[model samples]
Target: WDSVIDGNTSMEQFLNIALINAPLEKDYTILGQVLGNLQQAKNYLDLMAPMHASYNSKISKALSQMSLRMSMESYRNRDFQRRWFDAYISLSSHGEALKHIQSLLQSKSHIKGLSIDQDLRWAMIRQLNRYDYGDAQALLAQEKHLDQSDSGEKAAIAAEAIRPQSALKRQWLNTIENNDTMPFSKIRIAMFNLYPAEQKLLSAATAEQRFANLPLMDDKGPVFMRSFAAALIPTQCSAGNINAISDVLDTQTGLSQLARRALLETRQEEQRCVKIKLLLQ
Candidate 1:
């Protein structure tokens, strides 16, 4: 983040690294034949990239991204035409980013020809929905009509929960905090979608409720709360939010070790976000 803000690195590079690290952070290397295995992954992805068109099966593309990260290369994943999609939305004005996204969705994306991958399509919709776009429901409904699989159902639930509605935020908060019996599959998606860092105003409404839910998360144990705790952290690029999260870490001793570590890491992420905003401003 500092490197990017200081003009020592590109913003797109920083964003792609962050995206890769989220999934590839722990034990990311093979102990033996690391390069050999990595090369095979690279070979498979290189061979498979051209096959990824209407093929919603993202293993090929996803594997390619992972292999690129492992190789310390930047993620400009190739499409059928090898035409890239700058889908990460640059660190620019929100409206401008939305405009670009809207154009891509409208164009069905040149990268994939006349067809867009199902997962990629929903990802675009979810981004619009996060800003509470007026057509979120209709757009999500349209996509759901196209994909009736289990993955579709989960994505639809996440899209609905992600709408920037205060009531929906509050309702999901209760479900996350109180509904221990809810399957992790359901709750994890809800947790991940419910509180995007930019959605601080919506998050503010239930910020205290989330903080208070820490004990419940700890009681649920590491398996349930490890990812959930980090997901629901009410993060923003502001000192007030940072200190509020920090205070919980400082004074809250009942939290289990994993939950505490998750909180600390998330706080660090927010701090990095704060640095990016401050330097850019």
Candidate 2:
């Protein structure tokens, strides 16, 4: 909070907490800033990209898109909302929200649909696939055919990978840790989509291993570790999980400064979430 008021927090720190993408070491600082000033909301939303949580946020329309896409991502969650202002706007459940997003692409009785831009269209498709909705593979193929550009190709690759199958997810975890030759672009896609909040089974299955692999991941160097820490580190909002990671941090001497920062930041974020979970309870 002091750092935010003093106006010297790192940009990454601000963006991650704002988008609710992952935890950072000083999340509360930027969040307090966001609470104090309405304009700081976009500062919070800037980290979500390539896999669309809330990246590049500024406009209300952009937030409306994310609200529909991201709401109810976790079926276990109690509320469907996003907060740009002091109060959050209520949102619909997954199926209902998807229907509304789908309507924007085509006419719906009384509503004349507007043609959504390609990136936003892909964001919608990615959400649909994450929820394992209708004919996801076909949707990817059709969109890939429609665009046929480099960005489209990248989106297609990510869209295909985000489908929630245990076997595919296991394969991705291995690939992320071992495939050094994999392009950073694809790496970002895999990391971001591999563990949507809704896919507890996938994230839960490998949560321990994700932590265990930190040393090897850090050895890959900072560039890789930064992206991995930001996106691949699964969000486990439990005191036990936080303590487990804390134990590793307390004893693990092999982790680099960057890797250590990642763990600590994740710890702080998890702590904040734990408080919120208790309140919700």
Candidate 3:
């Protein structure tokens, strides 16, 4: 595996051979092999999941720590680090995984404060809330320094404040309302700030019009459109209209596969909601 990772052996050849001959052991060797090469990690994990599921808690804990270490090493590339953390956390129980992630976030000596991105921090907060609401509240209290003048920080604040369990929903809504003339990017952020109930206030046509007027020449236009699609999911939009919006999205250059998947999921959710509403009526 080391030779393969070090470029001595062809990756495709090694992967083909490993698919047939890889040992199903819960050991550091396998963990190290997967962590060392990102290209092969997903395939290797898929191959090993059946065997690895039988491992005892101790081996699982060790692998989780190793994954965290690998993510820390990739901190310079925030997107890659986030992907690593997301992949690692998805494999473990949410409660246990979030507890570990929260500990790492709170440990200032281990990870520098500024190195963490607001999106990643908010993702952790959302997961923490999923597992333990009180703990998430306490974390928000302790991490008040997350407040910044940037749009990302504002978006995070709005999202958290509008959460069903949030104590400051009214205050956050007032803050957003007071800033009516914010730029398109900031408006995009504010859209994400809307709660499910608030989302019903948006018109699908209004969203589509706003999206149409976006200056694609601007580097942030595609990003804004992506966020717009996400923010539209909980709104009272017709599935056909959502599909039309998605068709518009498909024409944008440089939009990522991740963004495209999010748009598709949003459309599916809209369809599901329509079915549920019809069934209830």
Superposed Cα deviation of residue 279, candidate 2 (Å): 1.4
lDDT of candidate 3 over 87-116, digit per residue (tens): 454333335666766775666334432255
Model 1 per-residue lDDT tens digits across residues 1-281: 45753545543454445545534333323212232332332222222223322231233334334432333322332331111222242111145445555666778434323344677677767777776654667888898898889889888878878888888888887887788587788888988888664466677788887787788777887777877776776665567877988899988988888877887887776676555443333
TM-score for predicted model 1 compared with the true structure: 0.64
- Report per-prediction Cα RMSD to one decimal: 11.6, 11.0, 12.4
Q: What would the TM-scores of all predictions be?
A: 0.64, 0.66, 0.38
TM value for model 3: 0.38
Model 3 alpha-carbon drift over 4 Å, by segment:
1-82, 86-93, 108-119, 129-134, 158-162, 166-184, 193-230, 233-281
Worst 10 residues of 2 by lDDT: 84-93
Instruction: Give me the overall lDDT of model 1.
Output: 0.59
Best by TM-score: 2
Ten residues in sequence with the least summed lDDT for candidate 3: 43-52
